[model samples]
Each structure stands twice: as C-alpha cells, then as structure tokens.
Target: MRVENLHCSKRINPLVNFLIVALILSPSLTIILIPISFLLIMVYNVIRFKLLEPSVTRDTHEKFLQFIGGEPYYMDLDTYGKKGGTYADAVAIDAHNLYVLHEDNAVEIPWSMVRSWTIQAPGADRVVGVGMTAAMTAASHNIEAAAKAHEASGLFVFVADVNHPKWQFRTADTTILRKWNEILTQRNEGLLAA
Candidate 1:
C-alpha cells in the first residue's frame, strides 16, 4: 500500500493543546509561569540524573488494570498510529478490546472493529528488534542496555476496518504493538467470552 502517498498528519496531543490554549488566554501569567517551569524542569533533570535513577516506564496495563481485567493481554502505551508522532497517551488493550482514555471521554473498540493492522518502526527499531519478549530477550545477549534504551523509542500502530475509518496511533515502542497483536489477535472469528 502506498505509504508515501499517505499524508503524515501531525498529531497534536490534546493535553498539550489545552495547556497551550490556557496559557495563551492568560499571556501575562504565561510569561511568568514559563520561566519558572523551565527552570524547575532543568533543575529536576539535572539533580535527578546526578543523584537518582531515571524513572522507568510505567506499565500501561497495571496502571489501568482497575478499568480492564483479563489475563495475559496487551496494553500499548495508548499512542495509536502506524506512522507520525507518538505521544504517551493513555491507551490500554485487553483480550478483546482496545481502550483509550482521553481528557473528557474514553473509547473502547472491539476486536471486530479491527479488520487488519500494521506496525511502523524506524530503522533504529529494526536494528534493535521490534516485537514481544524477543526484543527484551535480545537485549540481554550483549546488547542488554542498548536494547532496553531502544525499547522506549517511538513507533506507530495502524488499524483498518470496514465499518470504521482507518486510524493510526502511536506507541512508546514496537513491543507494545507486537504484544497487543499477539494477545488481541490470537483467536480469529469467535466472540470473546466476556
């Protein structure tokens, strides 16, 4: 399929958009706040790196397990897209559905709605590896630290369906997409018993 022909639309993260709007509406306060926030961020990064371990990626599943319950599922970083920018949005997946939580609303999509899917990873991801346990598994064999670092890199997930328009989402890494596909697509046509 002609991906080059497809538009690489920019994804404006909604929370960022809201904050920008709020700041614009209050320019006097924004000017004052921006400098303070920048200083704080710079200080935090400096001190955190010097004195503390870097933060780990929160397991997207465990974070929202209260909202979704099932064994052995896939929870992508909630960034949905096969290409383009990937933001760390609140996205989760279970055995039979994909759950996306937004600022004012949530979306739950059945597996039936996903007719097909594709994963888009950059050259870097392929060099490190791009799926499931294998990615992590590869990490330990001399490339452990490098692979782990690569694991948090960006990738996109695309879903195509007859009933709905084609959609794309971003993921923090390719493993999320692979794991999601493995769990969500294991069973073919039968309805998930829920």
Candidate 2:
C-alpha cells in the first residue's frame, strides 16, 4: 500500500523552514540568500526524507503472527508513542487486538480493552485552530503554511485499557492518523472484534 508516511516530518527540512521564515520576515535578504537557500532546501529535503522514512520490518510482522496470533493488516516503525518514553513502533491492529510494539517489548491490547483515542496538538496544551480557508487567507507571509503544514500532525493519545488509565500511547505518525480515522470511527466500531 502507498504510505503517505511523514506528512509533517518530511514536509520541509527544519533548516529550510527556518530559512524561509527568516527570508519572509526580512525580504531584503532574499537578494543574497535566495539562490543559496533554494539549493540548500532541495538538498536538505532529499536527505531528511531518506533519514526520516519509516518502515515496517519483516521481523515485526512475523512477531505479530507469533504473539498476537493474527495477520497484521497495518504496521509501521517510523511511529512512536510515549508511556513516559516507551514504544517506537506502533498502532498495529489485527482481527482480535491492537498491538503496540515498543523498542524492547510489545503489548497485545484487546479491542474490548480500548477506552478512547484522543487527537491533540504537539504539546500537552491544545490550540483551537482556524478553518483551512481562514488559516490560508490570514497567512500574509505564508506563516500559516508552516502552521498549517503541521495542523494535521498531532499526537493521538489512546487508552488501551481503562483499568490502566495512566497507560497511554501518543502516536504522531500520519499513517496512524489516517488508519485510526478509517478503522476506529463510530461507524466502524461495531465491526471490531468483541
């Protein structure tokens, strides 16, 4: 399947984004920085794209079969979640359970155990966002482009077991976002294994 992968991580390399912001704020410097910035940005995005690329491994899939005892329909490793810094690979769901694989361990969470999944901005604090049209129109200096690029990128905090309410996985992958929307919606909740 085609992976949109890091919609935010691979968008514009941080340095290029910095340069763009710097130029936008100080337009006169573009006369000297423009050509150099363009070349640097092209190079940076290529390199960062390669480095930030996330993949699901053969071992991960094999292990899923062994432990979860089901064929994994989705898996990813450029994924990360924090239960106070625990998993790096995440949000894998099979027929009976959702598997969250940590750097050193894995948890098989039954579908029935899941209490809820919440979407929120990067930091613990949430910002009420403007609509796409308003966000774009207000971006006089394309500042909104930077903000909007990250609009869809946020942490998905889920409680796999209500008893362990303190236990949470905050996944920040674009694939996880899309998959959660598709597989865990109200319309699809009835389809989950009991």
Candidate 3:
C-alpha cells in the first residue's frame, strides 16, 4: 500500500493540521492558534520520541532494565499490530526456561500484563560472542546473589511476581514455573477452603 494509505483515517500529520488550523484561525483574528500550534508540535515531538523512534543504543536495554529495576530478561519480537506501535520487536521476560517468553504478549505468561519493552542495543556484536554456557553461568550466579536470603532452606524457589510494580515475573528454570503454579493453586485452595 502507499505510504499515505498506511495510516488510519483518524490519524493525520500534526504539522499539516496545525498549519491548516493556524491559517484558518489567523484570518479570523484568533491568535490563540499560535499557542495551539506550538502545543501540538511539542506533543507531536514527544510522541515521536517515545512511541515512534526505534533506534537502539548500547544503553537502550540498560535503560529499560533500570525502568524495570535491573532484572534479567530475554528479547521477543512484538508485531502485534497497533498495540506494538512502530517497532517490529520487543524485549520480554523469559518466563520459561527457554530464552523465549513463549507468548507474544507478556500478559499471556500467567502473570501481570506488560506495559512496554524495548531493546537497548540493535548492534550485531551484542549477541555474536555470547555463549550459552557463559550466559547460564552468569544467570545462575545472579540468581544465587539475588536469592541469597531465600537459599537458606536448600530449596531456592524463584517466584514470578507478575503483579510486581517494577519487573515482569520470570524465573530461570521450569521447576520454578511449576512451583509458582503450585503455590498459586494452594493459595487459591485456601480461598476456597472457607
């Protein structure tokens, strides 16, 4: 389809609309259009930066990690039509043992819904030399470090708290997934116990 036809009818270029409105208003002695035009431009720029631009940086993922409170995660391409906006992919949590999140939407992972995700780096070098063994070792170490207080019982239960405000719920192993399911089941049973 043509570029002009790519957008929905409800959407139109802000600059074009602003110019048209300003021209029409100025002739009718409506100086308010000047400020309106400026406001529209500012809003357009903000939307462009936050929702449209997809340029990746060395710190893109890092920034996202900080947004989610520095948690480990995996990437998933999100092409879910209008909800995905302009980008073709997204970085999602590895809810499963595999690096893949399994479902296209993060909400489908039996946890809370995902607000948004983005890749920090779009460079090829990021994944080139990264070996799975090294990655797993580092992951295990991070888990151990993060789970220090909980490891005292010999059973390290990694729970995916999908409802947590900062991060999406995910674990490094399927055992944790099962454990979480069981925990939820038991908690639900308690509710039904009454």
State which candidate has the highest TM-score. Answer: 2
Tens digit of per-residue lDDT, candidate 2, span 1-194: 11112112223344656766576467576444655554464465445545444423334445545665566765554433211221234456766666655443466766666666655434223234376544334432243344344443443435544444422233445555666666766424676553
Give per-residue CA lDDT, model 3, range 1-194, as digits (tens). 00011121122356665675666466664555654554564465446545444432223334334433345433333221122222222233333221121111122222233223211211111222246555544544553454442222111222354443232222333344444444434433553221
Please list the Cα RMSD from the true structure of every candidate, rounded to 1 decimal place: 13.8, 10.0, 20.4
Structure candidate 3, residue pairs in collision: 60-120, 61-120, 78-89
Clashes of 3: 3
Native-referenced Cα lDDT, model 1:
0.43
Report, for every candidate in turn, its global Cα lDDT versus the true structure: 0.43, 0.47, 0.33
| Per-model TM values vs. the true structure | 0.37, 0.42, 0.21
Q: Model 1, 97-163: lDDT tens per residue?
A: 7665332123456756655655554433223546644544444343434334444433223445444
Arranged by lDDT, best first: 2, 1, 3
lDDT of 1 at 110: 71
Quick one: ranking by TM-score, best first? 2, 1, 3
